[model samples]
Every structure is written in structure tokens, then in C-alpha cells.
Target chain A: MYLFSAHNITKNYAAHTALKNVSIDVSAQTIFGLLGPNGAGKTSLIRIINQITAPDEGELYFNGEKLKPHHISLIGYLPEERGLYKKMKVGEQALYLAQLKGVPKAEALKKLKYWFEKFEILDWWNKKVEELSKGMQQKIQFIVTILHEPKLLIFDEPFSGFDPINVNLLKEEILNLRNNGATIIFSTHNMESVEELCDNIALINKAEKILDGKVHEIKNTYKANIFEIGYNKQEINFNEIVPQSYEILSDIHQNGISKIQIKIPADEMPNQLIKYLIPHMEMHSFNEILPSMNDIFIQKVNEQKQKSF
Target chain B: MIFLFKKLTNRSKNPFKSITMKKIRLIIQREYLSRVKKRSFIIMTILGPVLMASIWIVPFFLATMSDEKKVVSVVDETGVFVDKFESTAKILFVYETDLEKSRADLTKEKYSAVLYICKPTNSIPDHAMLYYSDKSPGIITQSYISNAMQTILKNNLLINAHNISKEDFDLINRTNIKLNTEDIRTGKKSYTEIKTALGIFSGILIYFFIFMYGAQVMRGVIEEKTSRIVEVIISSVKPFQLMMGKIVGIALVGLTQFALWILLTFFIITSLQIAKPDVFKSPKTEQAFDAGQKIPSADQIQLQKLQNQEIKEMLTGIFEIDYGLMILQFLFYFLAGYLLYASLFASIGAAVDSEADTQQFMLPITIPLLFAIIMSNFVINNPDGPVAFWLSIIPLTSPIIMMVRIPFGVPVEQVYLSMGLLILGFIATTWVAGRIYRTGILMYGKKVSYRELWKWLRY
Candidate 1:
């Protein structure tokens, strides 16, 4: 079942359109990556989902119900440029934000204590936000964003300011939240993290959703019929052994092994390439090559750019 | 379950109504607490009463504190003004026969100035000259000497040329006329002076409160924007709610400070009065105390009794004003005026990325307030005139101009109309400001212009 979805979303500012007929459906308890380049309407769409700004034309549903103001209480949003009140005490600000989301003060305090202890920032609770380091402040912001235990959390570039270790910790916590039935909408240009964590993704470019599906399915759909072969070099000549109909992208001879990348014909199966290659040489390895999300992101955006021109 | 049922019903009726009040309350609570807990707010709260009390007490102390006495040597060539000069606490007069000797003594710093009265070429002396080395005589001293000479010469002329006796002259000069004004409708003594003072005091107080608290609202908005917390905040609450919550919260802060100041000032003044009853005595009584060595004659005692009666009448005049109505109107105008301007300030703060960029937007907002203040004197002088009537009716200037006219017995209908118009104006400005603020807070790194703001309004 879909946890949240935006249908035919359209938004415009005075000078230009921010979004155009975009649609997205995020399934329950899945990490949905919203990928886009700078100024690509990802923020606009996220804001629409958060109800920070209403879409000029669209309908949004949460848990199969039309989105309303009350839905805000169930959703936590960490904007790209998120911040806390600088002069406010860390714990006080956290509790205030939680209360703003409709969490009672006692419950908020209880949750804050748990999170603060888990994040090892309990000592900094009484310190003003300005006195904390940037990473520490970001941690506090992260904690405040999720303190209400929202069902749907939207984080825009959540790992931008964090050190690698903290990023991993945040990643683990995000996964843990998902494991506890919380759905996450992650927006970022960090394709590696998308590859590592996202179950599904929608690629938006120039205010249009050009691609979206399960991450593995997208990688599979974008993958060319290409395979890499690693075999003993002294035993065979790669050019002579491979069929002339096949396209050899690159062939390299290093040490005692020869590795070559070749594209199979549409009629052939992956096993066919392995079967054809195994007869000629003692193969060490044979594998089909799948595209990375980064490669597909670049290729799709570039293709869209060319099509527009 | 009841919460869920209510939420469902509210959603069906109006989708945006759910949780708004709670969120706004949270925002207000945070805003109020953060400010009230600040060191500066505490300092100002304590300092405000002291400053106000000092404004009343400092002048009295300064009046009683004696200054260095200035001595003037009189060299009357006419010999007709001897023994006529009177000495006050600050100035003393002494007669000298030799003009050259007086001049020499002045240069030697024996006297502050040497006043040389020329012999009369006609009925009155044509001119008089004053000489000193470094320090010049004050205007008060110069006028006092000239007045003394003029009075003595006039009496001499009356006695010699007109053949009038001193008794007849004294009796004719003592024909002092005093006019007591009464309101014809109420048949009560009218206190125009006290009413004018009250009007000006309240008007100026409201004007100051609006600016001081309005700027605070703007700064608070700017702080939220600069810190980049506005996005997170608006995600939870509507921008309008956030803006209003801040405005209302800061207004409460202003009211609290004002209430504390009034109470503290009253307490301090009363305590001081009780601790040293003599310090709180009337200035006339204080003067009598200053001249402790002199025993008051029968006439002096009668004059003091008359002064005491006048003081009592003044106190009755102060109590005669409808303080309840005046205070109610003051609060109404204070909140109305502050809300009107604070919304504009919030929008300006949202439109700019920094405080430095607010100057351009601040001009238009400040102009009406300044114009109202500038026209207040005219309004006070001619409360029933056309200029005052129109200014009091216009919402932008009414908060101050109407206040200046209120104490002078403004018609109830006109006050009602002015108040209704002010509320409408506040609503209109808040609508425009909320529109601008919603768009402006999300926009960054762009230098917003008037055109951009216009576009934001449309958006």
C-alpha cells in the first residue's frame, strides 16, 4: 500500500514554474529517494508534501486520505537549509518544536531525553544552540525533526553537514526508523547514498519527473546488454575469439589475465555470452554489467536536455 | 477517540483549521518566553520605572538646589533707582557710586556684571549699558534689572507729574483679574491645560510603544529568516499564524513592560513620599522650608493658604477626567496601532535577507507614523477643526491624532468611526503583509525590490 502520493502536482512562482504535472507514490515503510539537480523542483515538491506550500494544481494523499493540515502533525520535514533558534536552549527548543507538532510537553521531554541520550548529546541539552558546533546543531535539528515520531519524514540533504561517521549513524538510524514502519522521503544529489539506501527513487529534472521506479528495476531498465570477461591472456586472442557481430567496448591485457567488455546482441541471453566465451578460454569470471544510479542520472538528464533543445 | 472524531469533523468542514490554534499558541509561548528571559528585557523592565520616576523627581531637585550667586553692581547715574533692586537666590544687586570703580571691580571678578543706568535725557532713559570682563550677565538678570528700574521710574513719574499718592498707585496696580472657565454642559470647572497634557502624554506613549515593539517584531522575523528556521516553522504552522503569534507575543511583552513600569513607578514614588514626607511637599511649601529663618507674616500666610487651595483644585481637576475611558481607548489604540505597523515590519523583515536591507522598505511604513506625530500639535490646538477631524478619521494618522483629540472631548460617534476604520486598516495591512511574508520568507539570495514585493503580493 502507498503511504503517501502526490498526483499531477503543479506549482508556480511569480517569475517561473517550479513544478509541472509531477506525480510520485511512496510505498509504506520504504526509503524513497527524490533525486534532482540544483533548481530541479525537488524542494518545491517536498514543500508541497509537507504542506508548507500548496501546489497550484494537485492532490496529495496520506495513508489513502486527502492531505490536510492535520497531516502535518504526522509528517516531519527537515529542509535543506534547516536551522534551530540560535539563542534558545537545545532541550527547550527541541521540546517546543515537538509541542508545535502536537506532542504533549511531557511526551516531548521523554522522547527528547531518549534521543539526546542516544545521540550522546545529553550534556549539551542546556547549552544554547549557538554555543554548539555546527555538526552538533545539525544533530539537534535532526532530533527535533523526528521527535514527534512522525509516520512520514522528509529530509532534504540530511547528510550534507555531517562527518562520515555521523552520516553513517544517521543512515543507521534512518534504516532503524524504517524498520519500525516509518516511511522516509530522502531528497539529495548524493547518488551513492541513493544506491546504498533507497528502495525506490523518482528522478526529476527541469521541473519534470523523467524517471521513477524501484531502484533495482531502474538500474535494470537502464542497463545495456553489456558483459565483462576476465580470462587467461596467454591461452587466447580476444579479438579472434569473440564473434564479429558482438561489440567489444574495451579490451585490456594486464599481468597474466585479459579482461574485455563486450555488448551482447539483443537476440542472445547472458548465458549465451558466457557459453561462447567459456569454449575459447579458461574464464576466471564472467558477469553482466548493470548501470549505476549516478550514470543513469547523468545520462537521463543529459538526454532530456538534448531533447528540449 | 473524541480527538479523532473532532479532527475528522474539522477536516471535513475546513481542512486548515485543525491544530492551527495549538501551533500558534506554541509559537507565541516560545516567542514570549525567549524574550522575557533575555537579560536586556529584564534590564529594561527595571530601568524603565527609574527613568520615568526620575523624569518627575529630577526637575524638582534641580529647582531647589541652589547655584553659585551672581552679584551685579549698579551704578545709577540718575540716582532715581537706588534701593529698588531685589536679590533672588541666584542673583544679588549692590549699589556703587563710581561707574569706573564698578567697572574695575567687575574686571577683578568682584561682580558678575556692572549695570550702568544712564541719566534720563527724556521721560525714560534712552539706553542702559552692561559691562563685564569674561562672564556675561544672564538674560534673566538683565531683564530683572531693567524691570526694577522701569517700575521705580514709573512710580516716580506717577507721584511727581500726575500728583497720584503711593496708596492710590498700589491700589490701582493690585486690580488683578482671574478668569475661571467652566464647561457649560456639565457646569464643572474646565481644565484645558490638564487635558492637553494628558492627551499629549498618552499619544506620545502610544507612538513610542508602537515603534519600539514593532521594530522588535521585525528583528524577530529577521532572526528567524537568517537562522533559516522559518522554513521548518512554517512547515508545522502557517506563515500567517507564525507572524500573528510573534506580533501578539511581542505586544504582550510590551504591555507587560508598560504595566510593570507604571506599577513600579507608582510604588517607588509612594515609598519615597512615605520615607521623606517633606520631599513630596508642594514646591511652594518646599520654598517656605528653604527660607526657614523667615517667619511668615499674615499676608504671606494668607498667600500660602491660597496656593494650597489652588493645588487642591488642580488635584480635583486631574481626578475629574474619565480615567477608565481614557485607559480603555489608550489600550485599544496602542494594540491597534502596533498590530498595524508590526505586520508591515514583519513583511519587510521577510522581504530582506539582512537588517541592512530593511532601510528601503522601512521608509513608507515610518512615514505615516512620523506624519501623525508631526500633525499631533496641530490636532491638539484645533481639536474641532477640519484638519484635525480628517486626520483623526484616517486610520494611518488616527491612532496618534485621534488620541491627541480624545482628551479635548471628541464626539463619541467620531471616535467610534475612527476606531472602526483603524481596525479595518489593520486587517487590510495584515492581509497584504501575510501575502508578502509567505512568499518572501522562502525566497533567498535574491535582492528583493518593490516590483518583487508587488509580484509576491499577487503570488
Candidate 2:
């Protein structure tokens, strides 16, 4: 069952429609990635869910209950642009913000300490936030955002400032959070992270969701029945045995091996291509390849772009 | 863990209370802590009291420091007023020959300038002419010479008329009558009562500065709101709580710093009491110190008293100050009066995002404060009168006006009425300000004119 759902959400900024009937059903205990380029109404939709803003026409349900003001306590939001009182001490600011999220003082501290230690920012706790480096500050911010052990967590560009080591640490922690019953919405421009982390994705472009499905399924749906045939120093002709619908994308000799990548139309499959190609050429290797999520994303966006014309 | 604890404790109490009060406390705390914690607060707080106490000592020290012998050279060309300029203090006299040389020489070496006295010339517009260059002779020297010269001239005329000896004239020298205030009410209502009223005036001055500046604090919050920091804070807490927390925090800071100031002042006055007891002492207690030291004699006191009637009347109820009441009313007015202004300021702050934007609505709030200050002066001048009655009843101006009248003794009814009005003003202003604050907090980059602000009030 879905733990969080935003149905038919729409938001208008005067003459501009920021979000139009955007919907998502985020399942519990999974990382549901929100992938979109800048200004695709993701922030507007997130704001509606967080209750920072009200949608012009939509409703959100959380944990099978209609979302209310008090439901804000159930969701932890780490905004893209960080806001921390510069003059306030790190610890003091963290506890204050956590308490504002409705966490009791003693309990908030216990959780905050656990996260601070896990993040190794406990020593920097006493110093004023302004004194900390940007990365360190982001870590502190992350700790406070999740200190309440919120049921659902929203992080926009959560790994923006982390180095390689910290990035791995954050990834481990994010997975840990999901394992601990927190559904997550992670939004970013980093497509590699999406491939590595996301269980499902809703890709929005031009304030509309263009693709919404399991990541692997979407990638598979975009894959052409293509095979890379390799032979040593072979001259190949495609017109006779290969169907006219088949297309040669690349035919190159690399490191003394003749290789050719061909695409078959939807009516044809890679097995049929392999069957037909064996009789026509001295085939060294034949393989079918799946498209990357990056390719699918770009392809789908381009499809939308083309459809607009 | 500890970090979270500190933050919670440091954060204002649960932010879900009334917003204006919250904002006031926050801003007051911010101003108080930021200002009080600074080295400047320490220095100024200590300096204010020290300066007040030294007022009684510094003048005497300055008077003593300036006691060098000041010479006066005179040439009585008309011979009408001769042998007039003589003094045994800092001013001394020497007669010099050649008027031109004396004038030049005196100007060169600072001989209190030469006085070239001439009899009333027919062509001269002024009846008497005394020539000096670029300086008034020090008062002591000028008074001595002018007195001696006038006495000599008068005696000459008297001798010509009646042929009396100088001794007879000296023995019977008499002046005109003098008028001085000897209040019919005595004992508990004497000089101390007058001094207490003066103290009350000081208390009122403090209330004004706080009231004025406290409103500034409110305006500052509203300015910040207009700028959009309120949104940044509101993201974490409820609007009302945010408002109340800020107000309480700021008030605490103000109280802390103010308490520190009072303590510092007490130390300053106490030190002065230990160091320079003569001035701080009552005039009666200091009579012994005046022995053979040129204290005002009975005739002189009477004349001085006649000349200073205006100051005496202004400070008439000075000795009747109620210290506890002054403090209590101060706190009441401070909170109520500041809340009233701050509520409006917070509304303005929420409505507009910047100081420039706030100007369009600032006058509507500020004019009343300015009027209060102006009206207070009037109330002090005419205590217990009709104008004072109306001025003291209006809450906006009442805090200052009533305090000004406190020295003059306002009726108990007026005080309670004024207090009630001030509180009512706080509530009404808060309601209005809250409306503006709620709408304006989220509105950004928009110019909020007074008309817009007024509309916000309606909405």
C-alpha cells in the first residue's frame, strides 16, 4: 500500500502553471526517486506535500489518512537551499529546529546525538554554524532534518556538497533509513545516482510527468532489439538476409576485430537477427543490449519534444 | 544530543502563542542580547551613570582649574566711571598708559581686553561704549569691574547732590526688593518632594527612549518580515509561536540589559557619594562646606531665587516622586506601549519587505509617538489641566504624558485609565498587526503602500 500519495495536484503562479495534475503514489519502505530537470514543478509539488504551500486543486493522503497540518510532523523536508541561523550554535539550532518538528526535547537530543555521531559532526556541535564549512554545515542540516525519525523524508539534492567518501556514507545512510521504515523522495540531476538507488521514478518535464514506472521496465521499454556483431576483418553487406527494417547504427573495426551494431524494428527480435545474420556473414559475436536509464530519460524527453511539434 | 538540548532550551518557548508578543520578545531579545553582550553596552551603561554622578563634581573641579590671575587694564577717557574694575580672584587689575598701546598689548597677551570707556558722545549711537577685541572678559572679572565702575559713578553724582561722605553711603547701601518662592506646604512636601519629581522626570525620559526605540524594534521585525525572513523562520515553527518567541526573547534581553544599567548607575552614584559628598549632599547638609567660601548670603539667595522662579515651578512636584510606582508604571507602559507600537510595526514589517517600503506606512505609527512626546511637554507645563487630561487618557501618547505629569501628580483615576487605554491599544494594534503579519509574511518582492497596508488591515 502507498504510504504517501499526491493526487491530481495543480499549482498556478498567476499566468504560469507550475504544476498540472501531477500525481505520485510513493510506497512505504522504498526510495522513490523524483527525476526532473530544473523548473519542472517538482518543488511546487513537494511544497504542496510538505504543506508549505497549498495546491490549487489536489489532495494528499498519508498513511491512509487525509494529510493535515499536524501531518507535517510525519514528513522531514531538507530543502535545496539550506536555511540555518548563522549566529546560532550548531547544537542549539539543531535541537530548536527538531523541536519545532514536534520532537520532545530529550528524545530529539537522543536521536540528534545518534545521527551526529554517525555523521561524525558531534565535535563541531558546540561551534556556531557560521564557523563551519559548507559541507560540514550540510551534514549538520541533514542530521537535524532526519532527527525526528520522520515517517517519510524529502531531500532535494541531498548529496550536493558531499565528497566521494561522504557520498558513499550518505548513500549507505539513505538505504539504512529506507530499511528502517522511512519512505524517501530523493530529487537530483545526478542520473548515475538514480540508476544506483531508485526503485521507481517519475520523470517530469515542462510541468508534466512524461514517464512514470519501474526504472528497469522503463529502460527495457525504450531498448531497441539491437545486436553488436563482431568478425575479424570482414566486409559485410546488410541488404540481402537482414530485413530492410533493420538498421546499422555503427560498423567499426576496433583492435583488429570487425564489429557492427544493428537495430531491428519492433516486429523483429534479436534472435531472428542472430538467425539471419549467421548465414550472411562470418559472425564472431552477437549480443542484445538494454538501454541505460540515462538513454531512456533523454529519449523520452526527446519524444515529448517531438510530440509537441 | 547535547546540541539538540541547547537548541531547544535556547529557542523561545513553544512558538504557538500570539504572534505580535512573540515577535516583540524575539526582537527585544535580539536587540538586548546583541547590544548588551557587546563591549559597547558595558561601556555605555557604566558611562551613563558615571557621567550623571560626576555632573555634581566636574563643575567645581573645572571652576578651580580656571583660577589664574586675570588682569584688566582700563583707560577712562570720559572719567565718568573710573576705579571700577577690581577683583581679588582670578581677575586682577593694572592700569596702563597709552590707549592704543594698551589695546594692542592687551589683545596680544590676553589682558581680559582693555576697556576704553568714554562718556556718552553726542555722535555715538550707543549711550556708553566699551571697546574690546574678540572676547568677553571672564564673568567674574566683568562683574567686578562693571559693579565697581557703576558704584563710583553713582557716588560721584550723590556727592554732587547731597555732599555725603563715602562711609555714610557704604554703611547704608540698599537695593530693591526680591521675590522668592516659600511654598506654604511644608514638612513632607518640601525640597525633597521637588527633587523626587525631578527623579520622576528622569524615569519618564527613560520610558520615552525605550518606548520610541522599542517601536523601532517592532518596525525592524516588520521590515524583516517584508524582506521574507519570517517565511524562513515560519518554515520551522507556527506563525503565532514565531511571533511570540521573538517578542519574549527580545523583552528578556531588554530587561537584562536595563537591569544591568540600573545596577551600573547605582554603583556610579554610590561611588560619587563616597568620593564627592558635597554636591550629592542636600543644600542644608552642605551649608558647613560653604563657610567663608562665598556661599549665597540671605540677600543673594533671595535674589537668586527670584531669578530662577521658572525652573522652580517646572520642578515643583519634584520631591513627591513615588519610586515604586514609577518603576511599576514604567514596566507596564514599556510592555503595553511597546506592544502597541510593535504590533503595528510587526504588521508593517510583515506587509513590506524593506525599510524603503516601510516608509509609506511608518508615519501613521510614528506620528502618535511624536505627538505623545510633544504632548508630554505640554502636560508637564499644565499639569492637572484639561489638555493634560485628554493627553494622558490617549494611550498612544499617555505613557509619556502621564509620566511627565507624574511629577506634577496626576489623580489616581487618570493613571488607571491611561494604563487601561495602553493595554487596550496593545490588543487592538496586535489584532490589526497580526492580520497584516499573516498576509505579508509570505508575500515577497511586492511594494506595500499605506493603502495596501490599510487594505491588509481590512482583510
Candidate 3:
């Protein structure tokens, strides 16, 4: 079942359109990647979901109900430019934020202690936020963002300031949260993480949603009939063995090995190419090459840019 | 997550109909606690009363401390003014024959000044000159010398030319008049001076507090914006809630500080009076006591009775002031004025990315407050005049101008009208400020102009 969804949301600033008829649905217990380039209205959509700014024209539903102020406590948001009160104590600020999210004071303190201990930042509890390093502060922010254990958490560039180890830690925690039945909307420029973590994604560009689906499904749709073959060098030229109907995209030979990429016709089977190449070359490996999310993002955005002109 | 889900289901059954005051209370608690716990607040709380008490006590000490006597040498060219100069506690007069000798003595610092009386060319001397080596004689000494000389010359003229006896001249010059002012309606003495002082005191205090606390509210906003914490906060609570929470929080801080200052000032002044009773005595009372010591025994009782009567009149005058009404009005205006100005300050702070950028917006807010202060003197002089009436009615200037007219017994209806208008003004400004603040806090890096602010208000 869908945990949260935005329908035909449109938002506008004074002179520019921030969002235009954008729609997205996040299913329960899944991480939904919100992918876009800079200034592509991704932040605007996230803000609408958080109710930080209401959409000029649209509706939002949380847990199959119309979104309201009470829904605020159910959703947690970590903005791209998130910060804590610099002069406030670490534990104090965390507890305050949790309380603002509608957690009882005692419960907030208990949760804060658990998170602070889990993150190994218990010693820094009394220290002022400004005294902590940037990564340390980000850790505190991350803890506060999920302290209330919100059912729907929205993270905007969640891993921006973290080291690789902390990034992995955060990734594990995000996945762990999803396993516990929380839906997450992850917005980022990092496509590799999206490929690894996201169950589904919606690609927005120029204030419009151009693509969205399950991760594997979208990849399958964008995949061409291209395959890479790796083999040992043989007497016959590897290029000559390929059918004339098939297009050879690249051929490279080095260190007694040959690697070639070829695009087969849609009418032809991939096994037919293997059948033709078996007798001519030593077959070590053969695999179809699918487009990475990074490649698809750039290609789609570029295509949209061209269409706009 | 399970807990949140359950809570969500429960809340979704009955969604919030309005912005939650609970969240705003949390914000207010944080804002108020963070400031009240600061070292600066503590220091100021303690030091404010000390400074205020010193303002009351320092002048009295200074007045009684500077009792150094001044000696003036008289060099009368015509010998008509010999033995005529009288010596008092502050100034002493001595006759000298040689003008050049007295001038030299003045240069040698033997005398404070040398008064040279020129011989009369006609009925009276045309001009008289006084010389000193350095630091000319004070106004008191100068006026004293001139008055003594005038009396001596006039008496001489009266006795020689008009054939009037000294007794008749003395009796004629002793006609002193005293005017008493009373409130015709209540048959009470009208203490215009005391009331004027109270009105101006309260007016200036309100002005000072509004600016002091209003700037604090602005700085708090800028801190939240520049620190980038506002986004995180507004996600949980509305921008209006956050803004009002901050304004109200800082106002409580201001009220707390003011209350502490009043209590502490009273305590300090009273303890000081108990410790040093002589210092608390007015200089006039002390002088009367000194004169009593030197005068006859019977006159001492009379002087004491006169001093007691003066003190009693002053006490009665103080008791006649409507302290309850004054305090109530002060509190209302202080809070109302602060809320009005603080919301504007908060909007300005949100519109700018840094404190330096607030300069362009501060002028419009400060102009009315400054104009009210400048017109306060006129208001005090003519409380019921058209200017005072209109200024006291306008909400922007009324907090201060109306306060200036309050002690002069402003009509009840006009005060109510002014108060009602001030509340309406506060609500209106808060609405505009909330609109601008919500949009401005989210915008960054761009220089905001007035046109941009107008657009934000519309948004």
C-alpha cells in the first residue's frame, strides 16, 4: 500500500515555476530515490511533502488520508542545508527538535540517549554544537532527523558531509529503518547509491517528472540490445566473426585478450551472436550491457533540454 | 517506526484543525531558556539596578561634596562700597585699597577674583569689571556679587537723593509673594512638576525598552537564519508560530529583567538609605540643619517644623499619583509597543542574510519612534493640544506620546481608543511580518530590496 503520495502538485515563486503538475507515490517499507539535477524542482517537491511550503495546486495524502498539520509528526525531514543551534548543547538541541516533532519530553530524552549512545557521540552531549566538527554535527542532525522514528522520512542529500565509513553507516541505518516499515524519500545527486539502495525512483527535470518506475523495470526499458564479450585472442579477426547485420560499437585487443561491444538487431537473438562467435574466438565471458542510472539521468536530461529548445 | 505509525493512525483519526500551540510552546521554552541562561543576561540583570541606583545617588553626593569656599577681593575706586559686601558659606568678600595690588593678588591666586568698582561719573558708575587669573568665577558667585553691588548702590541712591530711610527701604523690599496651585475639581494641590517628571520618565523608559528588546528579537532572527536552523524548525512548526514564539519569549525575558531591576533598585536604594541616612537627606534639609546648629535654640524648632511640613507635602504629592494606573498602562504599552516593533524587526532579520544588511530596513521602523520622542516635550507641555491628541491616537507614536500624556490625567476614553488602536496595529504588523518572514527565511544569497519584501508579503 502507498504510505504517502503527492498528486498533480504545482508550486510557483514570484517569477519562476518551482514545480509543475508533478506526482509521486511512495510505497510502504521502500526507499524511493528522488533524482534530479541542480534547480530541477526536486527540493520544491520535497518541501511540499514536508508541508514546509504548500503546493499552490495539488493534494497530498499520508497513509491514505488527506495531509494535515497532525501529519507533521509522522514525517521527518532532513533538508540539504540542515543545521542545529550553534550555541545550544548537543543533547539539548536534539531533544528540543524531537519535542518539536511532537515527542514527549521524557520519550525524546530516552530516544536521544539511545541514539547518542548508538552513534558513539554520548561524550559530546554536553558540548556546544559549534564545538563539534562538521561530520560530527551531521551525525547529530541525522540522529535528530529520525529520533521520533517517523513513519515517512525525507532526506535531502543525506550523505553530503560524511566520510565514506560514516556514509556506509548511514546507508545501513537507512536500510535498517526501511526494514522496520518506514518509507523513505531519498533525494540526491549520487546515482550509485540510488542504484544500490533505491527500490524505485522518479526522475524530475526542469520542474517536470519525466521518468519514474521500479528500478529494474526502468533499467530494463532503457537497456539497448548491446552486449560486451571478453575472450582470448585467436587467429581469426574477432571483428570479422560478427554478423554484418550486427553493429560493432567498440573493439579493443590488449595483452593476448580481445574485448568487443556489439549491438545486435532486435530481430536477432543474443544467443545467435554467441553461436556465430563460438567457432571464431575463445569465449571467456559474455554479458548484456545495461545503462547505469547515471547514464540514463544525463541522457534523459539532455533529451529534455533539447526538447525544450 | 511502529510507534510513529500507531501515533499517526491515532492522529489521522482526528487531524489538527489549526497550528499547534504545543509546538510553539516548545519553541518559546527553548528561546527563553537559551537566552535567560546566558552569561550576559545574568550580568545585565545584576548590573542594571546598580546603574539605576547610582543615577539617583551620585548627584546628591556630588552636590554636597563640592563645598569649597571662594574669596573675592573688592577694590572700590570711589570707596563707596567698603564694608558693604557680605560673606556667606560659599563665597567670602574682602576689601582692599589698591586696585593694582588686588589684581596682582588675584594673579597670585590669593583671591578667586578681583572686583573693580569704577568711581561714578554721574549718579551711578557706568561700568564695573571683574578679573580673575584663571577659571572665571561661577554663575552663582557672579550673580551674588552683582546683586550685592546693586542693593548697595540702590540703597545709597534712595538715602541720599530720595531721602528714604533704611528701615523703609528694607520693609518695602521684603514683600515676598507665594503662589499655590490646586486642582479645582478635587481640591488637591496640583503637582505639575512631579507629574511632568513622571510622564517623561515613563515615556523615555518605554522607548528605551522597545528598542533594546526589539533589536534583540532582530538579532535572534538573524541568528536562526544565518545559522540555517530555521528550515529544520519550520518543518515541524509553522513560520508564524516560530516568529511569535521568539517574540513572546524575548518579551518575557525583557519583563523579567525589568521586574528584577525594579525590585533590586528599590532594595539597593532602601538599604543604602538605612546605611547612610545622612546621604539620603536632601541638601536643602542638611543646610537647614546646619543653619539650625548656628541659630538660636527657639528658631531650630521652627526650622524643623518647616522642614517636616515640606516633607509631608512632598509625600502627599507622591501619594496622590495614580501609581496603579501608571503601572498598568506602562505594562500594556511596553508589551504592545514591543510586540509591534519586534515583529517588524523579525521580518527585517528574516529578509537579510546578515546583520549588516538590516540597515536599509531599520529606518522606516525607527522614524516613528524617534519622532515620538522628539515630540514628547511638546506633548508634555500641551497634553490636550491637537498635536498631542493626534499623536497619542496614532498607534505607531502612541505608545510613547500617550505615555507622556498619561500622568497629566488623560481622559479615559482617549486612552481606551489609543489602546484599542495599538492592539489592532500590532495584529496587522504581525500578519504582514509573518508573510514576509516565511518567504524570506527560505531565500538566501540574494540581496533583498523593499520591492522583494512586498512580493514576499503577497506570497
> For each candidate, what's the DockQ?
0.61, 0.19, 0.65
For residue B278, what is the lDDT in candidate 3? 82
Per-residue lDDT tens digits for candidate 1, residues A187-302, read 99999999999999999999999999999999988889999988777656656766888899988888877888999887878887776777777788887899989999999999
TM-score, B chain alone, candidates in order: 0.87, 0.72, 0.86
Supply candidate 1's per-residue lDDT for A114.
95
lDDT of 1 by residue, B155-256 (tens): 887887799987797666655455678989999887788888988888889889989999999999999999999999998888999999999999989988
Lowest-sum lDDT 10-residue window in model 1 chain B: B289-298
A216 Cα displacement, candidate 3 (Å):
2.1
lDDT of 3 by residue, A12-128 (tens): 988999899999999999999999999999999988888889999999998888997787888899999888889999988998998888888999999889998998889999999
Residue pairs clashing, model 1? none
Cand. 2 Cα-lDDT: 0.69
- lDDT (Cα, tens digit) per residue for candidate 3, span B66-109: 57778889888876689877666567788898998898888899
TM-score order, best first, reads 1, 3, 2
Clashes of 2: 38
Question: Comparing to the true complex, what docking class would candidate 3 get?
Answer: medium
Q: Count the backbone clashes (under 3 Å) in each candidate.
A: 0, 38, 0
TM-score of structure candidate 2? 0.76
Candidate ranking under lDDT, highest first, comes to 3, 1, 2
